[model samples]
Target chain A: MSGTLPSDSACYVYGIVPADAPVPEEVLGVGDPPAPVVPVQHGEVAALVSEIDPRRPLGTPQDLIGHARVLDAVAAGRTPVLPFRFGAVVRDAAAVTDELLAPQQERFLAALEGLEGFAQFTVRGAYRQDRVLREILEQRPDVARLREEIAALPEDASRYQQIRLGELVSEELTARARADADELAARLGPLAAATARADSSADQPVNASFLVAEDSWEEFERAADGLAATWEGRIDLRLLGPLAPYDFASQLVDARGRDSWD
Target chain B: MSVAPRSSNYMSRPSSSGLVDVIDLILDKGLVIDIYIRVSLVGIELLTIDARIVVASVDTYLRFAEAVNRLDITQDRSEGLPQLVNDMQEGGARHKTRGALEGVKEKVTDLIGGDGEEDEEEQEERPRRRTRPARKGREQ
Candidate 1:
């Protein structure tokens, strides 16, 4: 399997980092055999990769985990890694060096230099469902009156009222969520080097990732905690952090590669 | 390595611990070289769609209506509001969302059937790989 594998092998690329950055030896890469991850260097930048058989499918949850595991390890080790999107596979080692690393060497190096000593943190906040509903009720007397009217009637008798109440509540929830999310951004924006607003879903009003330098991680954590306490019971805030600058690095590289096709 | 003050109202952890957290980071965010191969990820796509089903649906509307309908309008106004809010908060949306979607897995299984089991088994056989910290709230 060893000899046959490398001949037909494609490389699953985990990410790119500076050439001098240390690769975590213990981390495994994606594929059935769990290929040993190694770096392919080109001048100042290096691509972290492992061999895979491209003929096999590569989108299992495990594959995704493996991809993230390698890159996360790199980031945790204080290396500035530009993580590749999951399932980035190349024909072979030559493609890793020739097609990927060679062409993007300068750009990757510059991004890595820019990203040095920084990590990513995601802060997510959601309104306490009950509190928000009550707030809506208090703010909108008509909605409150409608709710009282609907509550007095039987479910079967107030069918139209129920639908109307649902529409009103949904609209109110969305508006409050947007306003709260904006307030969160305004409060947390200055703490980070860069920030990206993530899509807010039904329950969550605020979802954002910040690129923070190593020195300011504590400050960021304190600010996040302060927000959590102030909005306690009203908004549930959680922070995930010291991660590879996924959002920031992706934006940097994606912008440069936008015009280049294949 | 300083820990944020621990509070029940907040949480901090590595993103790799949960399926949803990893999906957000791994799915679309990253550097994409044109030379790389892009496989059709049907499973991840289905999971994403399934996750959104609870957001805006007739089921969600009915649930909201039920909660609102139960509010006793005749009770002492100020005290009743906060108490009702507390009761609703205790019920927790995360659990409700999970419970509401229990049938989704069954439907997904029925749609994918035998092939789905095989895929699930493959995922199970793999080890849980942990590498970095990801901030995810209980609400997400």
Candidate 2:
């Protein structure tokens, strides 16, 4: 059964860190008994990697988490790391440098330098469902009326009215999300070196990642906290980072037609 | 030689992230090299398929309407003042977003990294992969 696996030379790459970036010890990689991460360095950059048995498939949740932890550990140290998308397995460590790093050495160095003294912050804000709905009711009489009309009917009977009401609410939600994203950017833009917008999922009004400098981290934190308090009940905002710059990484490396999503 | 980052008021939380945030940031938003071989990410689609909110559909409309209908507009807005403070401190969007999506198996890793990775599908056949459960909260 294991006869068809690729040669024993495969390596699972976590991401690219500066050649001088310190790899935190004891960080594990993908597998049942996880693998130990080793930096495969060439010139100015090193690929954080661990040898993987080609036979073991690597999509477990733990693998994904380990991938992020390794990169984050580096980024937390203020070193610039260009993260590789999870699930990248090259034939060997040499392939990481030959096919991945050595070829793009100049670009990776430039991107890493750009990321110095800066880290990415992600803000995800979900609408307080009940409160936002109540606000929608107060603001849109038509929606409020439809909602009321549907409330009085039997489950099957009000199907159409329910759909109509939901549609109106959806429109309001979309508009609110758009406005909130813009306001979030506007409020934090001056404090950030770069800000990239992300798609909001169900119940969320704002999802974005920002790149902020080290010295301004405190001021940015305060500003974000203030925003969270201001919209406390209406929209709950959670901010996390000084993280590996994932949003900025895509733009910095345009390999394999993977362009900037923002 | 490394300690937890107690550096700034700006980077509010530690590098530990919620499952929802982790999925959004790491699943499909990082660097993709052209010469890489991939294992089947069959289960990734399940975890990420609903990461982007699809709000315009009939099912969504109905869900929105139901969520709105559940609200008692006449109720006082200030009734939950203290709870709002808690939400600001810890119950922020991450918690609420988790509520909307299916529960992510509790993640134990303090893995830090930015918002997530690549979006392309690898052309590989699925053999043995354990994806997460079906996210059916808003499936209708």
- All candidates' lDDT scores? 0.62, 0.63
Best by lDDT: 2
Question: What are the runs in model 1 whose C-alpha is more than 4 Å off?
Answer: A1-8, A254-262, B1-11, B14-17, B35-60, B70-140
- C-alpha TM-score for every candidate: 0.72, 0.76
Tens digits of per-residue lDDT for model 2, A1-262: 1223446446777888889888768866565567788889999988888867666555445566667777777777788888877767776765666677777787777777777777888887766666776777888889878877877889899999998887787777778888998888988988987788875434556888888888898788788887877777677677777678888787765431122321
Q: Clashing residue pairs in candidate 1, if any?
A: A239-B135, A240-B134, A240-B135, B14-B133, B14-B134, B15-B134
What digit string (tens of lDDT, one per residue) describes model 1 on residues B114-140?
333343323222222222231221211
Considering only chain B, report the TM-score of each candidate against the true chain B: 0.27, 0.37
iRMSD, per candidate, in listed order: 7.7, 7.0
User: Candidate 2 docking category?
Assistant: incorrect
What is the alpha-carbon lDDT of model 2 when measured against the actual structure? 0.63
Give per-residue lDDT, candidate 2, residue B139: 18
